[model samples]
Target: MVDLELGTLPKGRGPQLSYRLDRAVLGGGRDLKVPGSNTILDVAGLGDGVLATTLTADGSGELLKLNSAGAVVRRTPRIYTLVSASDQAAAAYASDAPLVDGQMTYGATLYSERGGSVQSVELPDVRSIKVMAYANGQVYYSASVKGSEKVAKLYSWRPGSSSRLVKTVPAPLAISPDGKLASSLPATGSDAGCSTVRGVTTGDRLFQSCEQTIGGFTPDGSVAIGTPANTDGNCAISVAALNVRSGAVIRQWRGCFYRVVAEDNDNLLMVALVSGGGQAPFSKSVLVRCAISTGACERATEITAAKEVDFAR
Candidate 1:
């Protein structure tokens, strides 16, 4: 068993913590203190000892980053609309930009290190935009366009160029590493009424299951994980390993599982919520690392609350 620690805070109120798999401890964190509430949407590490977080403040949301010492490295001013019906906005780093907002707005400025530099990018008139991953001098995202009166079409961004039509994926699109494979959720009325995972390379349909959702793809494009939801809708999470090339389910595991995170050459880190009687606070989140080949999971540590958390090579 890895060293484990546990603590608690009030519901929806807690600090967001960052954990480094290398040290197996809470490396750096930030306390989000509001009058009577706390909301942390997402956290990501920049691989260079820097971390980023998206949070709501005074009803408006902003993105901020912290250094290795947990000091406020930079912060972006409130850019979200308070009256907007949906507060969901996807953010990702692009070049020197620490956070780029990928909403429906056109020519929106992207924020770079310390928010001192900003660059504007053109966007098509799409319903929604989502930044899936950023790496290798490129940023991958999905955009939806209105078509056939009320139909929705999906496209992916090609780095500095305009978006490209990957497929007519309905709503949610999950892109794998290197942006080579994209798996899309099915449309409601289509005959293919099942969740489909597709490969972007050969346009191959990988896996389809009514029970599983493709969480993400492994770094090497060798494997992928499918998360299963529970029928009763409590904390039902299961994982299945897939051979990316053959699209076969080679291994499976179950119980309150989250996506795979902080991967290395030999292991993959995953988080699972411990279910008991009461709903556990987010701060008490538990993380475990497993051998990628064996699926041998071991409790790694309890992540503290912070504004952002990420892994490094």
Candidate 2:
């Protein structure tokens, strides 16, 4: 069995609690005080250190680094709205603050983080950004129209230039690590029988899987989809992995998976709802690391009332 260490932090409180898991025994959760006045929006483990993004109650955000002791090492201002979901290093929303007026004008900012500072690069007019993926320093995103029909578009943004529409996807899109494959869901009006996975490089139709809706892509070009068995009320939820070239369902998991992150080749990290109720004050938010080959899932951690949370690599 793989060892696990689970950590928790209360809402509006800094990172103060940690739980250790060894074998089948779990140690008591402990609190480690840290200085900060922001809510922890996200946390990621990078190398031996930890990177955390926090948003203040005033809508300002910051990215911070911490050592193994839970002490702050560096902190930098991260002022962007609707940050990309795929890769944090590539693209972000145009405005540091949310827009008050309903006019649909916006841009995406691409940046490089060196040492502790971030240098900004600008992209073209793009709004309602959703997911972002990076490969070879290039950024890809799934965005949509701000109002009206609300159609989603897929674009690529490189440094020193504006974004180019790789494809105008009516549904959500996910890009592979090589930036060649784009697996997308079908449009609302299209037949809901199958999902399409397309190759952006050769304009070739790579693969198509039936009875599932494409959700996202893994870094290695593996496509993820939602199956018909998993549903939360009227909201459909399921997870599956598809081979990009063959368009075959290599592995699949049936459950209420709202958000998914491909942690590595053999593992996927997922945030799912508890069975108590579909609405808020949810039973609990669970984090699970599932083995791709065997579909065996081990409960890694849990959170309270977690809604609309995201995980990035």
Candidate 3:
């Protein structure tokens, strides 16, 4: 698996000014830098490459689609949150503060890109949007209203249809393919709480516990991969594959912390952090791929700090 890695050595004029964007193998391979002033903000999988939100030194933000070799093939306008299902389909939603409706609303734009055509709509009520999943032609997101910033609502929108409320949750994360189940956190900026899954319509919780934060669902939607807050006597972290409906752990790993960034049918791509011992902070970060069924791990990138490793989901 190739991971989105921040080049270990500093690039550009200053450390804060910019960083190099690169595609690197799971371990110790040459990092291929993307050509630009790419201070990477976030990225997501788009077909064989990745779509990244980057900031240039002059503060100009760019949305670029880079092929696997880290070369730009296409670029779009700046977007705050982006999600894509394939090269042919993608969505971006952004919000800015400008008073509306008795100062209760914010300025926002929601758009979809298909093939080479783009469709966009302005929203008056949404203060913010976090895209959870995109599929077919629809985009699913969690919205925070302007006044009720503490509250979270799940919504769905297709290019031609109006945005519709799906449900309400504390912090919506991922959704099931059939649009019936959703995973959420108990609260925002959680120090500790349950990573939960509930019915989108019925408001029934399918799984809830501090055991693990639900990372993502399998492509078939039959299994969920979760990462516990910590598994060590002090600092270790682990990943688990669970039966989606039952929350029963089927396969798991211990002794290291993992941030599961992306996955396909058979494996998960993650930034694994391993600590030296009890109560110690993670000493190293490495990109690795783990088999879904066997709990085996393979090296993807060299040992580095968390700031030096990144991946597009």
Q: lDDT of all the models against the reference?
A: 0.46, 0.53, 0.60
Please give the distance, in angstroms, between residue 277's alpha carbon in candidate 2 and its true position after superposition: 3.6
Give the per-residue lDDT of model 3 (tens digit) for 141-163. 77777676786778888888788
Off by over 4 Å in 1: 1-38, 47-51, 78-118, 146-154, 168-172, 188-193, 229-234, 281-285, 302-313
Ranking by TM-score: 3, 1, 2
User: Which model, 2 or 3, shows the larger lDDT?
Assistant: 3
What's the alpha carbon RMSD for model 2?
Answer: 7.9
Writing each residue's lDDT as its tens digit, candidate 2 over 203-245 gives 6777766666665666666655445532437333556766667
Candidate 3, poorest ten consecutive residues by summed lDDT: 10-19
Model 1 lDDT per residue over 214-243, tens place: 656776667766666333554435566667
- Give the winner by TM-score: 3
Candidate 1 lands at a TM-score of 0.66
Span of ten consecutive residues with least summed lDDT in model 1: 81-90
Q: Rank by lDDT, highest first.
A: 3, 2, 1
Between prediction 1 and prediction 2, which has the larger TM-score?
1
Worst 10 residues of 2 by lDDT: 19-28
| Residue 29 C-alpha lDDT in model 2 | 25
